[model samples]
Target: MTSRTFAAFLQRSLEELKEQGLYNTIEPLEGPNGPTIAIRGRELVNLSSNNYLGLATDERLVEAAVRAARTWGAGSGAVRTINGTLRLHEELEEKLAAFKGTEAAVSFPSGFACNMAAISAVMGPGDAILSDELNHASIIDGIRLTKSTTIRYRHSDMDDLRAKAREARDSGKYEKIMVVTDGVFSMDGDVAKLPDIVDIADAHDLIVYVDDAHGSGVLGGGAGTAKHFGLSDKIDLQIGTLSKAVGVVGGYVAGSRELVDWLKARSRPFLFSTALPPAAVGASIAAIELLQESRELQERLWRNAAYLQQGLRELGFSVGATETPITPCMIGNEETTQLFSRRLYEEGVYAKAIVFPTVPRGTGRVRNMPSAAHTTELLDAALAAYAKVGRELRLIP
Candidate 1:
């Protein structure tokens, strides 16, 4: 039976969230999440998916998934450390290692799990982690799971990071110090200052961890942010997601063979959570191979992103300081942002609003992701929708 206290707490919390305009109402998509989506019998141009290279719905990947399902059954049937580590898992890890130009790699069920597993496995009470203030929620949660001290430096502030590293190092209160940051900030789409971060880590003998979730398959010819800055060898841990640009599912940490070995041995998620299913593994392998085979998809993605971003800018919408394809159309008010997204839906666009907890208050936005699968005609139509909504909301002149 449900506890009365628990029920009351849940009711009060939900009411508070609703009054604050923080309740997120999810709408189901009627079909595959691709360049376009169907909702309530209406087809809309989808600009909210992380399918950067559009491999999620690619026929090749779909066929690979189907083949894998047939070959390996529906599930791996156990946790990885038990009996679930299939040959496909090994193959996917190998492909990831090759893709990231690392000596080895280890996979996790999800990108969020990678953070929870890796950070807690390697860091603890005797160590300290210097994190970027604007790091993802998963990172923050991972830091919370650790008993280690966490020092947050200002977002992308290299000087603050250096000072924190120096202070932590000089204090000598910890045995190990790691500086962790996202390779590409998801919200703002700005690339991390990896060269500077690497330099600071080198100066202070700090282990470097980069969660390149948003950079993989979009930067460095699709190798990722570390490779983009030619610092692949310098970064101690390079984390990436198969769900994003790879257009599959799962996550991995690519680094030295010793690091991968340590993670395989100690990471809790890899030990307890069920391994990625054969279908996702196969699709991920195909996606990585496709990325390695040619830069055509990436080129298409960049061109589409540039076109959409330019269109928004020309429409007098602020896109923020985005170095990658993730475009955020800034709307300072939460209600307005939600209304703006609803207006877009009515106008045949499917970009969603990001507000409150996802971003800082008063920094709400409608995030647009232009994928490789989208045609110029689709982008032009999306732009037209944006223009209409902006005018209707008085968000643009």
Candidate 2:
């Protein structure tokens, strides 16, 4: 395409998004992303962060990062295949494996990269992937990159998944079949039926892959969704991100030692990308150790979620069906969802609205992420704001 053609296409697409109320205006946080954050110098109750256990601002992790920076310097220096894999990286992987209840684990620069690397490493042209319709974007892109046959089933519909899996297996056109899903749907805050998924996998001899980015530090006493259902060993691939609950940046894939070995030997990201910095590696190690040592933070996170959810429900706002701390206020339609989020901001709440392409159209919502760092008093303030804005907009009684 010509430069002028590309420029006009970009401008037209952005304009279309803006007109449709789908273009998001990202709010910059002026301070640490904690229970309350300073946005544009105004402090607001932060309900948009993914710091489930509130470990992002933990002093222990900070100190660990500092010590690591002082001892190991700023970066890992080269790609993992070219001497970038440090003792720090190995230690982090080992700790991650123990935390996830897997035999071995491999790390990547980001959670998104982990999906791409993990999927492509094991799947190819003749293979097929039975994906949940609501799987993350990275997973979809990973499947596309593999040039494999992709079959999408309804979100968490066990019957649909079972039919699709059986059909794919019986087709005999594919060498291998994989059933992949998100342990916790980020937008809906609902968990996948892992028990049902596993049964289907076993019936068809399909490989199971679960991307538990939002579940790793929030479910199963902080062990994750698979363990929440006691199917950790039955799962073939368990993917996670250190950036969210772990309060650092990076991603990982955990499973049998052979799986990890294959990833180390064949995954492109592991071979081509630079390793995580010493600070991130150290902080992640600290985060996992903290999760293993105590359940205090996870408990607080649930309490906060329940409190906020009850408040929303009492105010007649629909919080989605979520077993985890991710509380979403369902306000149908793009315009209202966007307006509601703006009002929430004006009322000193930091909940962000999620709309189409992220979730199905007309099911837009203001997704709230409660954390352990939030106090009752702060949560009360947020609830008050939600009530006020909801009533003013006739979103609730």
Q: Report lDDT per candidate.
A: 0.94, 0.93
Q: Residues 155-238, candidate 2, lDDT per residue (tens digit)? A: 899999999888988989999999999999998899999999999999999999999999998999888999999999999999
- TM-score of each prediction: 0.98, 0.98
lDDT (tens digit, per residue) of candidate 1 on 1-397: 4799999999999999888877888999999999999999999999999999999999999999999999998999999888999999999999999999999999999999999989998899989999999999998898888899999999999989989999999999999999999999999999999999999998999999999999999999999999999999999999999999998899999999999999999989998999999999999999999999999999999999999999999999999999999999999898899899988889899999999899999999999999999999999999999999899888889
Residue clash pairs of candidate 2: none
Q: What lDDT is obtained when candidate 2 is compared to the true structure? A: 0.93
| Top of the candidates by lDDT | 1
Which segments of model 1 are wrong by more than 4 Å?
none
Model 2 residue runs over 4 Å out of place are: none
Cα displacement (angstroms), candidate 2, residue 383, comes to 0.9
